[model samples]
Target: MNQEQLEGKWNQVKGQFKQKYGNLTDDDVTYSEGRFDEMLGKVQEKVGKGKEELKEEISNW
Candidate 1:
């Protein structure tokens, strides 16, 4: 998937998490987003892949 599609999927997942766990707040969602970014950064550093390439790999998984 492309960047927009990847982001749309992430938002859907985030929404589902919020709905399933009412206790989760916006801050928690923000933290999750940050963690995902960090993970992508680390993977890119190790694998030498572009951001879009990594995102597409994740989407395929």
Candidate 2:
């Protein structure tokens, strides 16, 4: 999926993010209002993964 599609599906993918980052509250993820790149970066930092890997996983989600 492209960035637009990714942003559009942010809410659905957020549950996966929450599962990956247990420390982040629902409000923290939802409050940004679909700023997914930032959220993805944060999740990348937390999980120690590369951007490509994250993107692949996000596409699957």
lDDT of 1 by residue, 10-43 (tens): 8999899999999999999999899989999999
Off by over 4 Å in 1: none
- Give the clashing pairs for model 1: none
Q: What tens digits encode model 2's per-residue C-alpha lDDT throughout 1-61?
A: 7666766676677877889988989789767655767888899999999876898786895
**lDDT value for model 2:** 0.78
Candidate 2: 10-residue stretch with minimal lDDT: 2-11
lDDT of 2 at 18: 85
The Cα local distance difference test for each model comes to 0.91, 0.78
> Highest TM-score, which number?
1
Give candidate 2's total backbone clashes.
0
